[model samples]
Target chain A: MKYSPALQGLIEALRCLPGVGPKSAQRMALHLLERDREGAVELSQRLQVAVDRIGHCVQCRNLTELEVCEICADTRRDAATICVVETPADVLAVEQSGSYRGRYFVLMGHLSPIDGIGPEDLGLDRFERRVAEEGVAEVILATNPTVEGEATAYYLSDALRSRGVKVSRIAHGVPLGGELEYVDGSTLAHAFSGRRPLE
Target chain B: MKYSPALQGLIEALRCLPGVGPKSAQRMALHLLERDREGAVELSQRLQVAVDRIGHCVQCRNLTELEVCEICADTRRDAATICVVETPADVLAVEQSGSYRGRYFVLMGHLSPIDGIGPEDLGLDRFERRVAEEGVAEVILATNPTVEGEATAYYLSDALRSRGVKVSRIAHGVPLGGELEYVDGSTLAHAFSGRRPLE
Candidate 1:
């Protein structure tokens, strides 16, 4: 079927996101055109505003409208402790928990050898330099529990260990009330290896 | 979770659209900040452009950036015949088939009662006027096969029958080679009843 090129273009553009597919894209495009004109416009405007105004924080590479991110700029945040995460999304997740009082360093991506993504690709040179110079007492590796996440955690550990920074990965295990059988193989294995003493 | 008010505001605004729930909106908000800044800006610009510029064509009530829609503006399309549809997206569907040579009359909605959407809400008066004045030979009611769609079609048929225009409803049946075993009751019954002479 020969759809209008304009309509097709909109759908294709929407499909660029991580999980959205052609059908979902079509629905989104139509919804934007029909109902949420303002919302769609806001989304588009916010995107451009963010793109033009926002960039990686000079300290942590987190998405920020300023040179230094909100976390880095906050006077109350512990400058001595830095939580290292793979993406800005992870930083958001940590922030949502509202428990961590430390600053953050967003790697912006994980180390995926199969995908040709490595330390250099993530600008780890800058990160290592920051870890050494910034007087950060401890670095918590909060990259996801995927293979790439683990690899990134290890890579960061090796790079920053020489600078005497205490590096640790985020704990991975069965979710609250999750059955052992229901847990994925990788997560289950990580849980077994990283087992802590039960109080 | 203590997200910034501005961030929370943006996410809530995003969830107003159909299919966009809280989680999806949150993900979209993060993606906008992190990866797809330019794309988001473009989308925002397009949304505004579409909302501000595109409106109903004075002649056919189809969506248009100008007073007359692209289909109505095209000299090659048959103005004498008009295909009536419920929404602008429905216009796209018909256009995608590449079969119809006529222009379109977009209702923008249907005769939804529980939702307080009536004939006036769908701009049916404009349709009646267009049919009355314009030399429209035939009106193909291509609304979706739903209750509101059926009622809208019936309403239009009764109104147009007195106005000396050929009014016809689009065919309802199973797709070609669609097995009866897989087909639903209503569709199967419709297929059996509307079955044509075997040549």
Candidate 2:
């Protein structure tokens, strides 16, 4: 016989998570029911609360419960330079690096004409308004290095240049700890093309 | 900046699931928020419902929302033979194989004295009561091949022999699809010792 209705429902519902499959879902459901009911309850409560409370920041379009996200609300951060990224996770990635001191603008997704996504869908109008009205000096394009991400960065650079703001894309190259032999061809090409002369 | 409070809480809670780490938790939480809010809501509702409703079946100690599980309630299944397994998942595994026509008794866990889990914790006394009252003729031990599982099986076999019930353990061998050359020494040894002559 199959699992009881509630157990079956939990397993099926858990499949919505990225990378989770039938076996993993079953394991997770059983693990929770058999050993960690408290954790399951906490997870359920937290998921519900997060879904109910979380929303996009009004100014930067990053995820937040407040109208403005923490980085966007901070006065100590440099407001003149904005780092544009494709998702909220990228904001966290940059923040964890502890190098960027500027605020951020989340595009939410890259331009994909095949998928019907465009500038308006990415809130570029709002971003441009912020740029023109706030006297922003530079915008860094930190979208992924995929084809769609490159196309998005190119489009943004064209748009921002005409608006009189300096636009720069994050560098692509071999990673710091990676060996040359294992570096992908496209990245090696990017490293060669964007090479700098050491003083 | 760190993830917003609600998002952070959701991510942290998601980590309660097995095989999910910080990165996977963030991805799952953000994925649910961005792409599958409906799924997230369903998951939350189902998890809450499952935890609140699901409990061990009174007769078999298997997980179910009712006093007796569907397998136990079904009259067509053989009541004279019982397949004793370690968990509800094992019950499903046996059912899916379409081989066993008998009812099941779930141990919930194996005997591990170091963890202070005893026969009472495994509901062995309840199992014994069923064997005595229900006229059960045979019991199949389908516990895992681990040391604890073997110990549990041996303990159950010894206890069941005195109750006028035929006790048997499922075979330990190289799996149907596995190559014998690559099989572990213990499994190979068990396979050799348990070999039966062709009729």
Candidate 3:
């Protein structure tokens, strides 16, 4: 069916979002036009504002409207300890865990040579400069457990250790509530190999 | 983690889309900001333009930028045989099937008294007026196969029949290429009860 030009445009544009396909885009467009015109307007305005204003924090490379993010600006947080993560979402996950009291450095993405991503693309030079300037004592490598994440963590640790900075990787094993039988083989193996003796 | 004001606003606004929750909204917001700013801007512009320009077609209440939709304006299509559907998406589905040569009447939604929607909301009076004015020969009920949709179909048929207009319902049975063994009990029962004699 030939939708009116504007309607068709909206449907096609909605497809740009992750996971939204043709059918979903159609449904969303119709829903916004029919049931929630006000919501659509709000969304449009917000998208415009966000796209125009939001930029990476200079200190942590996390998304922010300001030069520095809230976490980076907060003086009470530990300046000597930095938790490195791949994306802003990872920062949220670590914050939600509520155990960490350190600052964060968001890489935005991991090392991906095939995709042409490198340390420079991830702002490793900026990170190294920050570490030196801040007199950071320890760095926590909390990049994901994926191969790319591990590679990035290893590179970061190698670079930082050469400059006399202590580095630690987050544990990779079965989740706290996960059953052993359901745990993947590699993770189970990691758990067994990394097990610590009782004091 | 506390996202910047603009980023937070975008994430919240993204949740207005159907089926998008907090996590999905966050993901979409970050993705658009990080990887697809141009797409986000295009989506925003399209959304604004659609909301500003698109309105229901006066003839059939289908969404369109013009007073009459393309299907309604076409002279070759059978205006005397109006295929009624629950939404514009259903119109697309029927159009894609390539069997129906008739124009469409989009009800936009089914009659649901609980949701405060009635014949007036479905524009049944407008449909009736159109049928009378155009000398419509047949009205095909192609609403969804749900409770509200069935109730709506029955109501439309009854209303149109009283006015001496022919009305027919699309078949409800085992779908083509679907196995009988895997078919649900209710559908199988519908197939049995709706059985037609072979020529």
lDDT of 1 by residue, B107-156 (tens): 87889899998888887887788877987899999988888898999999
Cα lDDT tens digits, model 2, B4-45, are: 999999999999999999999999999999889999999999
In the predicted model 3, the residue pairs found to clash are none
All candidates: TM-score: 0.87, 0.97, 0.97
| Residue ranges of candidate 2 with Cα displaced over 4 Å | none
DockQ of candidate 2, scored on C-alphas against the true complex (2 decimals): 0.89
The segments of candidate 3 whose C-alpha lies over 4 angstroms from its true place after superposition are none
lDDT of 1 at B91: 79
Model 3 agreement with the true structure over A67-108: per-residue lDDT tens digits: 888999999999999999999999988898899999999999
> What are the RMSD figures for all models against the true structure?
3.0, 1.2, 1.2
User: Model 1: what TM-score?
Assistant: 0.87
Q: How good is the docking of model 1, as DockQ?
A: 0.40
Global lDDT of each candidate: 0.77, 0.94, 0.93
Q: Which stretches of candidate 1 lie over 4 Å from their true place?
A: A1-23, A113-116, B1-13, B74-76
User: What lDDT would candidate 3 get against the real structure?
Assistant: 0.93
What value of lDDT does candidate 1 attain over all alpha carbons? 0.77
lDDT of 2 by residue, A1-44 (tens): 68999999999999999999999999999999999999999999
